[model samples]
Target: MKTIAILVFTAFLMISCTSKSNKIIAQKDYDKYMEIKDNKSKDFAQNEINFWQAKYDKAPNQTSYLSQLASNYSKLFENTGDVKYLYKVEALLLQVNKEYKYTAVGPIRSLGRNYISQHRFREALVLANKALAIGEGMKETQKLLFDVNMELGNYAEAEKNLKYLTNKTDFDYLIRVSKWNDHLGDLKTAITFMEKAKEIAVINDNKSLKIWTFSNLGDLNGHDGNIQKSYDYYLKTLAIEPNNSYALKGIAWIAFSNEKDTKEATRIIDNISKRHHTPDFYLLKAQIAEYENNQALKSKNLSEYFNMLNTINYGAMYNKYNTLIYADDKNTAAKALEIAKIEIDHRPTPDSYDLLAWSYYNLGDSKKALEIEQKYVVGKSFEPKLNYHLATIYKANNMMAKVAPIKKELLKSTFELGPTLEKKITNL
Candidate 1:
């Protein structure tokens, strides 16, 4: 009888731990955020854009009005994930730069940032170099160069640029440093730096900075397995910007990946899509459908996503996603390879290399994939998806010894990889 009691208590403890581990999301904490509300922030941005646009129309030579229009358009893009707004901003900035004959560092830097958003890293790098040569706004241009260099996998140059902007207390410097540490896989240090940046944002009471810091900390915390903290940070972001799709997506991810509450996740995502209408949201919905074994729903969502991509020429912004999707299908594997090479040409980042390697692997050229992985991806990137591809490629090459440690690491990253990949990782 005593032995039976011990077994019962142990079983209860195991179940309790399992429940605690799974119960990371609380509806009450994020339910208010999920409620649709009047998007005053977006309205204000549009009003600002209209005001500036009217002023620019009245005095076409007023470059300041053009800049204001571009800035407001960027804010609108943030509030609503409308790619047209980004293109509008890009066109406005290009006009401004052309008017200035590409001699103005301010417009050049702004255009560089716009290109970065479009994933045109090489063009951004060119703009950065032009701004650097202009010898105005040297510090800001250096920051832009650092960002472009990092995106282009010019790590040595990125480090050099970072060293030039070495102000530990500066918000921009701290955030970039945090990113660098994260790229190096020192997530704890990354969080520490980001927390410092968050303190600066709170001290300044800068709404935009606060939103950026809180949302980024939410992502970093999620990556670190601090799901509860991640959810709270995302809520904080929503408190500041009620229409922040990114924060809402983070909460949806917590519901789907950590709690396995696909229905609730779908609810949040569907709500966001009603407002934002971004392509990636459809991809995420497809992933959830795949997880739930709803093949028809998955196919529908994927078809919708591709249709949207075709309808809207997003330029190279969706290349990575397109590459991954194409690589997964036998018929489209060659198309994936073509897109992957284009991505590499645009930005030879380890992540891009991983896409190319994955394309090769999908085409049954595992040896070629192994070569690329060894040369570019093995330790150059630490993204969970990249690591998963590396492990799979290693296994394909019969490198079981290399696959074991990565599989162990990836088991802890199921939440980041999402529910669909959880079983795939387990099989690995």
Candidate 2:
């Protein structure tokens, strides 16, 4: 039986903060259980602000109050997809760090988490190391360190830290285990870990935890070729947080890829784009319009996506997407190469290397691309997306013989690869 791992925190919310029953039911029942109070009237962030603000007013210098306030802002950022809350979190944490002499482990961990959210892995690593050095938050700090090392492509170090952190059966341990297995391309094991984590979260009656786990389960199931399960899980997530952008995006993908309903997909994504203001949603719109051969719609959505990217000035946060966009177009090849180099300098992970190699490939340097692929990407990753890129890179270099094995592996997960891409793999 495939275990449904509970969705846990995103990498951004994985630090210092933070389930029970196992009852299998039908999809309809699952949706019913997922239904909860409508979240729109909750004003959860404002409530948090009121509580923390009152506490802070009582004692302006209290590091504890300030730390809680920073955490609240972090949640607010996640809730609203707004950078202003992130700015508040950073400032509050910095104030706490200075006032507490950098010895306050909680504030340091929280600040490090904020940095991680912003994709500043190196800075987060520095703080993680400091927390570890002071012997504060050893387990949580070590977890943060593990995550940072993974982002930076220090896989060996990440594994060592992961081993140390996986000795417990808590939510953190299970979720991290799930993520580790996922990274190693063991989707089954990852889902098992997530299921256990989700079970615990449910038993504990943690709404946020449930929302995270359900959303993740939906994605995992979708990636594992179980469309109904994925759709159900996404519904469950929406039931908890009606305006969840992540859940909305997942639903949109299911509609487009599995259901082949581009109209529904467009509607879902448009809702997400209006609510979340995320540039990637516009990219999805572009893809849908491309499939329909609506060049005008595609151009409009692509322009909107780029406009959003430009407005955000997201820096490294947008590096991966920017590299993809640049690599796909000859006019942007040089810029893609530039972004790829910066990404490799920052992370050097297999994914980053893949992007760098792809940039080279797009620039007509197949030999350079092949070298990068062999050294960093080929055997290091199990992601079908990267494998497809590898096969294409080999084909570009006239290494037709080398492409067969990758095509074979990719064909095994046709459903996960989606119909459009499945057709491409068949041709390959």
Candidate 3:
């Protein structure tokens, strides 16, 4: 009787929690909750910014104060995804660099982080290298170097730096290990490392860290064809930080890709776009338009996406997206090839090579594409999108035997491909 009662109570609790979660808080209610929950953090960040600003104002020539103020602005920018805060970050950091002749490791490293946030990876890499030179043997600087190297597709160099910084108990180290494993085509090992990192975050009681881990695990699970798990993680992230743009985007993808509900996907993204002004949001809208067979809307969204990209200093930021847009459009094959070459020149990773091969295939150079695919792309990445691209390339090159296995693997990723693309994949 005791065991039965406990089970009944557990089921009741589950139902109660689900009912509460299903009660959609109106926008007003959500706003009230956020105002009460988030204003404290916002006000705290502003207070720090004011404090640092006063110090910098009093000592106009003090580089340390300038760097501190810049860091506060960065914190504000991160807390709120406002581009204006980034403008201030760039200005203050530039002033500090000018005063110190770029010798101060703090400002340089901070500026590199800002560049990374803006998707200016090549610029970030240059500044990271400078930070390393300025602060040789510093672990933090080495970590920045490792991240920038990975962004640039310098896998060997990234690994070298990572080896010097790896620590089992360190959150950043574990996440990096997960990313490296993912890049090396080991999804299972990658997920294990990410889960370990998430466990560490939970044990540390770090809410921000937990949010980051949950969002990343959501992405990893999505990539690995675990759609329900991915959706759960995204929901968990939203439960903590309701305005997390990445989690919103992840859930929006679940709506579009897994649920085949374009209207819901549009609603989620539209809500997010009203809050966050990221260029990728527009690109996603374009993809949705394509899926819905709205050519005029797709072109309009794509144009808006490019226009938004032009306004931001995205150094090597959208190469992958550009490659896909250009190659798939066929009319832009030469442009795609141009971007692919730039990607390969910056980071000769397998994904970059894959882009190059796809560009060649789009340009009707199937023989060259096949050669590059065999030499670089095959067995290098387990990404479903990469596999789909490779399989299509194989088909174009008359490799019929190679097509079936890849097609079989890809069909399992129906959620990843979205309903429209999944239908096309089924045809393939």
Candidate 4:
């Protein structure tokens, strides 16, 4: 039982915000929820985020307004694929609970999403339980509870919630079950679940669920090392939502990983670049330039990346490009250093600690990197990327004797690449 994201705009709008002007602003954002659908609109969501952030400053503990604001931040987090703001959102929700007598399911669902983001499946399950206990008659949020349980490796609980998904107003209910089934380690079962959702989305022409299902299938293929199949799935996804910048990035990476066709990869990369300003697009340009052996262009683009990471406070935007989009380990080290400074200074969380560790590891500071990595690895399972870095650092420090067990584990991971993952095995 996967939980559909019910924006709950109307319900949230009712309790939060008293000022007519602020309500008007929230209405403006709600309009876009229905009208806008493109990666280009990522920044537009940011603008709404800014609006809510400003409102938060003016009225700090106003539960209604802050709850509304938290929702917007959650949206930004989803778009950027960064989770730091999740910790921030959790903090805000706690504040909401403190200020208002009641705890709402919206904030709980948002936090569960964050836990899911971090891959802290068990923790997410616990929080989802809290949300379910507090939310009466909110079937969607209850489904979210079931979703987290499924993610937590509890298949039976997810199956129990199937009855609530019957003929949902939105087909996301079906899609959620499919993903939960996928996580349960039964590919055949997962496909059967998704087939029902796909059938409904196709019949109704639900763009959101159509794109969602296709992208998911693409990831499943990629995990199995079926690169061409994954590539074709991604192509199908883009046909549904041509401006889904994330999918565009995915296809470019597939081209790079499978074909290494500079022209084809660069074309996809350029597609992401044409969208609204993102620190990532510039980084992609740098990567394209590097692939072309255009030293001057590469240097220029890298310089922009440096500026964005150092000078600009793109917040999640900086991390989106520097942290998530790029594949070059060494270059990521530089960007990570800049990101660490900002994150640790302006805010701090497990992710910031991990970023600093990766930067230090890349810059040859094994001792510092090891210390920070040790602190971060507790919650690091949510982040397989960090495990790769840790393996690299351990091997470099003559700790292969300690790394062998982890290497064996990595070799069998769902995300493993044959030779690519082999490179991490110490003493192999």
Candidate 5:
């Protein structure tokens, strides 16, 4: 009888552990964050913009008011995810740069950042170089150069720029190092560096830095398979900035991907969409609909996404998403190939090449796809989606040996890829 009791107790303990592991997120933890409707940040940004615009109108010669207006518009873009505000900022910054005769590093660097946000990495790099030639803000320009070079896949140049700003105790240096480590696939080291940066953010008590650190930690933790830690970090982000759409989206991802609670995920996304209205949210909703096998809902969301893209002059910002979407349809595969080539010209990153390869694979040229993957995509990118494409291209080319390892790796990334791709990855 004692032996039977011991066995039952062990079984109960195992079951309890399993249950605890499975339940990573609780609605109560994020319910208040979701209920936050008032966008105080956006209100303040608009107020600042109005004040700056009035000043600029009164003193047309004062370029400083233009800079202030640009800053406010950037804040609005950050808070609302509106591309129009971003474009407004870009125009204002360009005017500021022209007024300064491209000699001022401040507006030059700002324009470089704007170009980076627009995915115009080559343009950003040129701006960074121009800033470097000005020699007014060497360290800042080095940092911008590092960022632009990384985006353009100029790793050696990025490393040189990183070396120029190698202050281990500096918050900016720490975050950049963390990004470098992440790019190198040393996730544990990357998280450690980011955690150090988070500590500095806490010590400085800087709201923007804190929000950036917390939200980035959420992403790194999610990629590391620490979904509970990721959820907690996102909650911390929301605690600081209640209207932070990125943090809310992270929680929505946890609900959808880890918990498979599609209804809760959709609810959170819908709430965010009411205010943010970013096109990517529609894509995410469509993905959720696909997972639920709601074809009509999926089609509606995709149509909305495409309509937004068609209406907005987003430049190259959404090219990758457009390429992937078009690559999946037989009728649009040619367009996907065209955009993929444009994306390659824009950045030439391995991920861009993966899009090109995937487009070729979809267009019924596995040999060309394999050639592109071998030259650019293989061993260059560690993204799960890119690896899935690599595996698909390999399988199509009768390279089962290459496909096997990638398939194994992808199976472990089902949570990150979400429920919709689980069967697809399994079948790979």
Candidate 6:
């Protein structure tokens, strides 16, 4: 009964759900769209507009149906990054504002989302507030309001709404709480909630929720400086659903930061940029080029990067690498080392230490690497790659006595202890 009431209220809030005839149409379009909605798939989400439209055409008096159609179309624009589609959304949103402004929740939240997309947080907040003022039953309006307030840096208001929604105690509410913590720099809290979302996805057998949680986990790992952990999470997400451009971006970032493999990094980012043209894609490409001896590519990538002003990590890596390259000349490298050290002072986690140690090592000093590797090798020794590097480094400089311990670790590591490999390890 409570479930029924909630669903009814949610439908009231969204302004519509489905009639049998429309449900048939929506189901059909969804099936067709899914075929094309690859990870890079935007058209599927767009075609949903058509499904909703077909429903509205069958029952034009159903303002709720039209409202949903407009929202669907608006989201297609958001998902695809097509301004023309958003221009379509702009008109559709206006239509909802006109025909059903009295009770249409769809256009309200849709407009807020579109405004946010345009970086018009002020406008977005207004629309979101208007939606909240109107009596709607679902938490989505609250969620959008929370997000808009957060975007405007109204963290207190955002926290109030977020707490309300979080207390709903449903799977959707849990996911929302995770995302809220994610943006607030509380990554550990984000992961804690996201893990609950992951469990909910598994219990409900919901692919969308699974993909979202995995990607959120990936983002959280990246924030914590677990670059490889971030990469692996993204890959897990991709294994479930490819064409996830964001995950693909994570791949480029992880490769660059963790492996420092420019070749592989460039290839991955370049392919994604060909399709997406996101600012992050170009910035990563520039970073990879910066590492190369090729001046032409470096210049091109830097030009692309500079054209993007609001990038995170802008100038940080470039400054670090430049200093590392010319550490002695103007003592630029020494200056850069100091900068890295200052950053580490603020966040002395494994990654900060690892980066600091590597910068020092690149300055022809391995002493720092030796110091930080102890922190980095934290139970990760079961992996073939790092253990090998650490063990070899230990073998060098007459530290071979440490080899036995590492070999023992390598043998005990997860990768080496598979059921099939157990006999082999035993024989060895």
Please report, in order, the local distance difference test score of every candidate based on alpha carbons: 0.83, 0.73, 0.72, 0.55, 0.82, 0.54
Q: Residue-wise lDDT of candidate 4 within 144-229, one digit each (tens)?
A: 76666544434566677766667654566666666665554455565666667667777889776777666666665555445555
Q: Write the per-residue lDDT of candidate 2 for residues 104-173, one digit (tens) a residue.
A: 7878888887777667888988998999999966888778887778778898898888887756688887
User: Which parts of model 1 are misplaced by more than 4 Å?
Assistant: 1-20
For model 6, the local distance difference test gives 0.54
Worst 10 residues of 3 by lDDT: 10-19
How well is each residue in 284-401 modelled by candidate 1, as lDDT tens digits? 8888999999999999999999999899878998888889999999899999999999999999999999999999999999999999999999878878889999999999999999
Number of clashes in model 5? 0
lDDT (tens digit, per residue) of candidate 3 on 298-399: 899999989977887555657778898899878999899999998887767788899999999998999899899899978877666778888888888788
For residue 52, model 5's alpha carbon misses the true position, in angstroms, by: 2.2
Regions more than 4 Å wrong, model 6 = 1-43, 50-68, 71-79, 166-168, 179-185, 293-295, 302-428
Collision pairs in model 5: none
User: What's the lDDT for candidate 4?
Assistant: 0.55
> TM-scores, in order shown?
0.94, 0.88, 0.83, 0.54, 0.94, 0.58
Candidate 5 accuracy as TM-score: 0.94
Candidate 6 matches the true fold with a TM-score of 0.58
Q: How many residue pairs clash in each candidate?
A: 0, 13, 0, 1, 0, 3
Better of 2 and 4 by lDDT: 2
What are the runs in model 5 whose C-alpha is more than 4 Å off?
A: 1-21
Worst 10 residues of 4 by lDDT: 9-18
Whole-model lDDT, model 2: 0.73
